[model samples]
Target: MTNNQPSPDGILRLINGYWATGIVSASATHSVFTHLENGADTAADVAIRAGISERGAQTLLDGLVSVGLVGLRDGRYRNTAEASAYLVEGTPASLSSFAKLKLTHMNALADLPEVVRTGGPVKQVATEVADNPHWAEVVPAIAAQSVPAATIAADVLRLPEAGAISILDVGGGSGIYSAVWLEANPDARSTQLDWEPINAIARRLLEERGVADRFTCIDGDFHTTDFGTGQYDVALYSHIAHQEGPEGNVEVFTRLRKALKPGGALVVCDYVVDDDRSGPAFPLLFASEMLLKSKQGGTWRRADYHDWLIKAGFEDVSFHSAPPATLVVARQRRRPVL
Candidate 1:
């Protein structure tokens, strides 16, 4: 005989999800992964380097081992491959900052029930308010997450071969796309439009990457700012669409269409859901974060994007997969031959 009843194991794990979050966050905050990568094999070594008690370091190491982010053998600890690649402090794809950022965002989950009931965030942190301090911290952390997707987008567009191209990055947080594209095509120049505080952060990051010479910033709200006419060869709206409603997105797309030169491409990298509102897991789950943080934001469908792009005077709209996100590329229609 077999039981038909569902097991409580899944429910238990869901409720205890914060345990995993806390472990990762604490480990990142204490630089456990970095220390491990730097030859700290014992908890004592890690504790010495991280300035924590040996017992505490041991417990944290055990927690990390349990989560498969760290490995333990012969009573010694080491960062797992994934941890070394992404959790180390200065790796090209480091996510240490992103993990630490989540520790701050985790507090907002407590208000989910109220937010759902009220149909909006109780107090929005993901918006443009003059000198919004949240952007200063969150922007750089998210830039790491965008690196892979930005590289993919740049490759797909053959940015390296597209010499002397002009790029317009709308609401370009942290300026990762610009950095990647500029690095790929040394002759390319990119402009970013965003809040002044966020632009300040982007300037510092681009300066560090040595791409500041090719990058410029327009410090203002994108909604009110003029994108200018027929100016750019490529335009990017990376990771900003989900924080807006349909009308807002359509309006922005219209402006971006005008901002592009004839036949210019606009690349929108975002967590786009399926037409039927089914799951690719992460994007579907990310909708909850948008709901908890934004007044009118959610993972939109591909169909929604197609409709908006078409309505906004774009042609050849298509989608491409860049895991954990999607790229919706649309082109401004070219003029007819005489």
Candidate 2:
């Protein structure tokens, strides 16, 4: 009975908020947001466009409207501003398809309890595109959403005055960062490393973006392959570091450091928790996904990244915020003289 008072069980309400994610996933899978992209439409029109029963579509749209992902006016529906910007299929920021793909992995959600008990990716992630054809299909959309990620990396690259440059993009899906960089710096060339199918997607995207001539595709397991030391001026590990644990991340940067010229930069993009690990809902939810899927990965603190950067022989380490993510930049220290 302390003065804090029995306001509401806000935390429990949030925990129960898992239902909202399910609803969003359902609407996305049904293409509700895509249909709403052009303008508001009656539920019947939406159902026809999306090929769902109008009755069922109405239920889904109502749920979306209730959740503020869609808006209703005069018995017609439209995407909410946030949903239009980020959930519509053709929009540059569309992540609804990604959300739908993740929902297909709902089996992973079932293993959350086991992950908490054992810790680590409960199963090896299916790296083969055959095992998951969705990876290729989603790559373009994910790359499209990653413009901000690529832009931030380019900004970091602009800070230094390096001559002819070669960048190695590790796990670089769709060559998004390299594509953006190449567009900005005609002198820059890149090698995009990812699984074959993802690399194929990257190649297509690079070509469409008109930078394929300046890029190379490397297909292999980064964990097992030699990334080649002293070859690249920049190495990027965008949106993938948090998929591996601290030691795993350290191993990655260590290899990249070996691969870098003396002053090479490593740009990492991921959702980062504040050092306090208190809030910031996005990274926290991303951490929850890691909890279900990864044996070692979770959203990490900026301080933790700094420690790993130092241990990996990176000297000028710092963090910067971009929308929906934080970019970690670290430069390989000059090779120590004996």
Candidate 3:
């Protein structure tokens, strides 16, 4: 092998990416980040604290060190600044819940080859929840990582004049949007609809945020639920449509049309693909993961959303200038009676 030979970037990235997954899984499984939260510890000490063999802990720590996610001082191991902030369990910035979700549902990744052949997520993910009750806990945990994105959704859903502004947050996991809106629009309150278990977490989060008194949790299947005709001044469906196929998308918007007051605004935040669906890596990657993890989910084009909005009686459908992920806002065509 010539030392001066140009590196093979494509093959190397694929090869190295697999190792990153293994490292993530190992650190999460051992709770290494949690272990190093306060300060560094020797490998043997970490093993004792975490109930693993000293040799195993040493190897894991060494791997973390090599990956630059952890560091060594003297003979002690510690999380790097980035890992310390976002992987430590109790930190507000922690994404440990998201990591745990991935670790718990690793079978999703393992079964990707089969999913490719069948062109669907394994039926069990949706249909066999009783056998997989663990998914209930994992789903809300996954949503917690996306709370920052929810803040953006809430900000856009703001109504200028608020005297009892009624809001509907559909499939609003963890109640982040409702929480933000209720905080900002003091007179405004919300109804958050999502799966029962996920809604439990949302209720708790809302209570913790001191907004539970202003919000109601509706634990039901949103597709079949009556979202209340002409009840809300604002409706938000954030990070949900892509998982529901085009037919479901139309059904949801149709429901929203009846739910909103005249001239009410609908705010949708999603990873929308360009009209051509050619690029923008996050949505494309998410699309692949969606295919691997959901039955009918796929990223939609921006134009498709405009068409859906128009079909559902929305006028002035427009995209936000910020964040290429696409924020679609539309107003009900009917003017509210003065």
What TM-score does model 3 achieve against the real structure? Answer: 0.80
Q: Which candidate comes out best when scored by lDDT?
A: 1
Q: How many residue-pair clashes does candidate 3 contain? A: 0
Candidate 1 local distance difference test against the native? 0.91
- Candidate 1: deviation at residue 18, Å? 1.0
Worst 10 residues of 1 by lDDT: 124-133
User: Where does candidate 2 clash, by residue pair?
Assistant: 120-294, 120-295, 121-294, 121-295
Q: How much RMSD separates candidate 1 from the native structure?
A: 1.8
Q: Kindly list the per-residue Cα lDDT of model 3 for residues 1-338, writing each as its tens digit.
A: 38898779767867676566666667777787898775538887788777888898888787788778888877777788888867887765477767655655555677778888999976555532423566457655665555555556556655434668989999887787787778877788899887787788788888888989999988887888899999988898888888888888988998898899887888888888888878667787788778886788888888989999888878879887334466789896775569
Which candidate model has the greater lDDT, 1 or 2? 1
The RMSD (Cα, Å) of candidate 3 is 3.8
lDDT of 1 by residue, 120-226 (tens): 88884657475767777888887888888999998889999998999999999889889888999999999999988889999998999999999999999999999
User: Model 1, stretches more than 4 Å misplaced?
Assistant: 1-6, 124-126
Overlapping backbone residue pairs in candidate 2 total 4
Indicate the residue-level lDDT of 47 in model 1.
Answer: 97
lDDT of model 1, residue 283: 94
Candidate 3 stretches with Cα past 4 Å from truth are 1-6, 29-31, 34-37, 41-85, 127-132, 158-163, 320-326, 333-338
* Reference-based TM-score, model 2: 0.85
For each candidate, how many residue pairs have backbone atoms clashing (under 3 Å)?
Answer: 0, 4, 0
- lDDT assessment of candidate 3: 0.77
